[model samples]
Target chain A: MPGLEDLYREIILDHYRNPRNRGELESPPALRAEGFNPLCGDEVVIYLAMGGDVITDLKIAGQGCSISQSSASMMSAAVKGKTLAQARSTIRAFRAMMSLHGQALDGHGDGASGGGGTGAVGPEEDERTGAEVAAAEGVSLGDLEALQGVVKFPVRIKCATLSWHTLAQALDEAEKGAGPD
Target chain B: MALNDFGPPLDVARIKKDFPILDRVVHGKRLVYLDSASSAQKPLPVLDAMQRYYETTHANVHRGVYQIAQEATELYEGARAKVAAFIGAAAPAEVVFTKNATEAVNLVAYTWGRANLGTTDAMVTSEIEHHANFVPWLQLHQEKGTELRFLPLGEDGTLDLDQLDQLLDGAKLLAVTAASNVLGTLPPVRLLADAAHAAGALVLVDGAQYVPHLPTDVREMGADFVAFTGHKMLGPTGIGALWGRRELLESMPPFLTGGEMIRDVRLDGFTTNDVPWKFEAGTPPIAEAVGLGAAVDYLNGLGMSAVRAHEQALTAYAMRALKERYGDDISIHGPPPGSERAGIVSFAYKDVHAHDLSQVLDQAGVCVRAGHHCAKPLMRRLGVTATARASFSVYNDEADVDVLVDAIGQADALFG
Candidate 1:
């Protein structure tokens, strides 16, 4: 009986209606990356100004459904001032939380700690990998934790993660010392 | 009953029962299928016919003097006759069986276009055509150096006939769809046919979306060629037909010149068979054609006029219900109320990606199509990446529409 109303929370709706930091940053020292969801036509362009290990500035410009755009808005805010290591750690944690494998991050002695009561696991096992990736990386991602609900809707998972994937792409480009764009 | 009312009133519930695949659960709920635009569900009669053909008449047609070969040839030609009658063609010889509508369009482009079109020749189509209709013509343009033109659509999703006059000038062929698979807009086919004829252009109607819901008569439409698929019309996959005027078929070169399509073959040259056989090369989809024939008989028994009426009523009800429930939060594409249109309704819910909407609907066991519907140019015209579409058929009713409306309302409440 869980409905779409449960998926689109008021905060998500607000971000979609009144999108924050919704513009492209000019090219310079920033690494920019673009991600596209072919199924939904959701696209994201992430700009990251990395000052050594720390991300000094981050912004996103994209057009997509509420889930994708709001997820991007939330993503830009979360990674703005984090160090490169911290950003990767936070992304791992966030991905883990969304994949409902946060128990792996909880470290309850058992190496195979499953995130119980998360209701994140679905019939599709591929989703569990997202959680496994997050568990592998060490960070604590909260609030964005709400996106775990996306696992129940497989198609929406792409929308919720388009921005994150773009951010990951940006970081990859930064590591390579190449412009993300 | 009169000859006009040759068919019986469709027992929709019984027909629905015949489709065993329809009686299944998806996402832990009863499946409510609404994606008939992509492909239609098979009925028991069509399925049984195909099974019977494979069981009894399983042989390569037109070669062996064996009993099975004769039976197979008879059944295959009979299927061709049924297809010809289904579309109101004068004879079975005018119907050429192809793999599907895409291949049918390709056949025209490769054979007809290559033989007739020159650098000075032109091909005209609309923006709303499915890629099957669009790409083949584009390939023809590339190969023959022919000019390719498109009839622009108005804001309301209808073709601008005023623009059509200009595009049709000096055009050799007008390849257009009878109904848009995405927008659900039924173009003015008779009008376009007349205009193309006046401009000295032969018309090829892509009836892939149209044939499934409405009754089609090639003579009445005055089209030179009409292409459609069996799968979309409650028939088996891998079978489709291209109905062309007898003269056109005779004049056009063979599409695939091999095997049954040939009369005599020498080391240096070969002679092709007559009319439909000349175009249908290799081993045709014999069993699939048999199923298609049964499908035609089934639809004829149900009466196409009634089917058309039923869908129109369902579409109107769906449109009214969607507007009432969601107001402007949902954007419905295609013709307005009372205009000639199909049961396909393509739209995007405010702030929700079509895939997201489809997921929400799938969870509710309400199936629909989410993507460009193979009309990328039409999607660009509509200024959206994709839209979720729910198309109706004879099997669909008010309850089906309610499922779609309720699902959309749920998506709106969840994502808005």
Candidate 2:
């Protein structure tokens, strides 16, 4: 049987026990967004400092189960100092990596600089594009990639995605130049 | 059955068989239903009674003069008698059927609040009331400018009645729950009633949670009005009763007027029907009432005292087993062991989201409720947005608790 050792990896547990970047930024240059999972009492507040097209800094603070808190910790570390375009691309790559059937990217391109991509593709084609994009971008998702195990436990998916959703909302707000309270 | 015979040490297996739905599967696993505080599964007798009523004596009650209508009316009124008797009301005429307990509480708020409460009048309630009980009074407060006071809950989830004397002063009404749906804390109803009465305030008991597991006598509790739903007590949905003192019901004006609730209607004005019917307007849940009567019979046959004892044992066992396994990691809400509490257990496991916990339990075929439980104020008071709750009934046993504990153990492994 799968155990906590498999899901709550040492790094994940460490983050939960002693989380980094776990407080609100004072008068943040970027927008702040809050996300809550009503069913589980999981809550997260994302703070982003944006400079033009780039995310200069990112921080997340909240209280929730280990999956949610650790996921937020990892997300804060991964998305900091990345551009808006780069952040969106990384989200797509991360989603693809978590796919149970090892499916490929659908609409997103294979780490190409510009937008124009193929209309439709098979599952294998999508996987190839996802892998090619990760390699080309040299995006080191690192321990953040361990969240692929979360898909197996469908319940924990919400926890893993809590920070990502908040971050997405915060980025959207930052793009609009409106602070999300 | 004798009262002594129906005391503690109930037969849980036989009780489990009485509920037909307990035998079914959900999500390809045997259903370990622990959401009875939300709504209970109906027994065969209640289902059959509803079916028989619809099949044999289906007609508009109290309006038609035909034989079937007379029979339907008899059964409907007979069900009122059963409800009145069930709650130890002084007379059957005091019981008014409503769609559900929410409607029952609203009826009292609209009727009694209009008559008794002025701008200066105040209503005292606890934070533990379900939204059904809380919202109507809140609306009353909004409309009439009545002051809404709340009794605080102690850390153990029981009401801190030490301040009841101070809180009850100048209050026009006190609406409280007999048993909290979330915490399962059985409040001091009789004492509260006495205190409220002494303070010249009426008392309304929300019996939605209590009537299922325990035997309630409204008169004995000294409550002026007691509201409960049939669905939570093994009956069909869309049926509940509000038992008020006869004089109080008679003094209060009609909440909803039209149809069978009237005596005479004219172009200029209309005269209302007598007592309970005046409160119950239009076509009521006649068949649902018959089903509730059958449920009462079913429970009476098993004996409510036995049912209460059965749930008490199950709750105690669950508390002990869960504490032994999880220790401080699992925080159990409500009264401590040996305290007077119902079967519901609201809890949170450290670092486990309630929804995730419920989903894990669901996968193991152990169903429980995971949310704020319509007690947002209580949830806020508890400092949690949501909690996973496992509520017991006559049908639940130690084995069911074992399943719940096992599921939680599995969840611990997943989130540790």
lDDT of each: 0.80, 0.81
User: Per-residue CA lDDT of candidate 1, range A68-140, in tens?
Assistant: 8877887777778887777777665665556634322221212121222332343333344544554666544
Clashing pairs in 2: A104-A126, A104-A127, A105-A126
Error of 1 at B193 (Å): 1.6
Chain A TM-score of candidate 2 vs. true chain A: 0.75
Who wins the TM-score comparison?
1
Cand. 1 TM to true fold: 0.82
Which tens-of-lDDT digit does each residue in B1-416 have in candidate 1?
23345344556777788778778998677788899998899888999999999988889998889999999999999999998988899999999999999988888888888888888898799999999999888877787789999998987788888888889999989999999998888998999999999999999999999887888889998899899999999999899889989998998888877788898999999988998999988889999999999999988888898788777768889989999988888889989744478989998787577876887888789999987787778887888878899998778778877877887766655664
Q: Could you tell me which 10 consecutive residues in candidate 2 chain A have the lowest summed lDDT?
A: A111-120
Summarize candidate 2's per-residue lDDT along A47-91 as a digit string, tens digits.
788787788777777767767888788877777888877787666
- Global local distance difference test of model 2: 0.81
TM-score of each: 0.82, 0.80
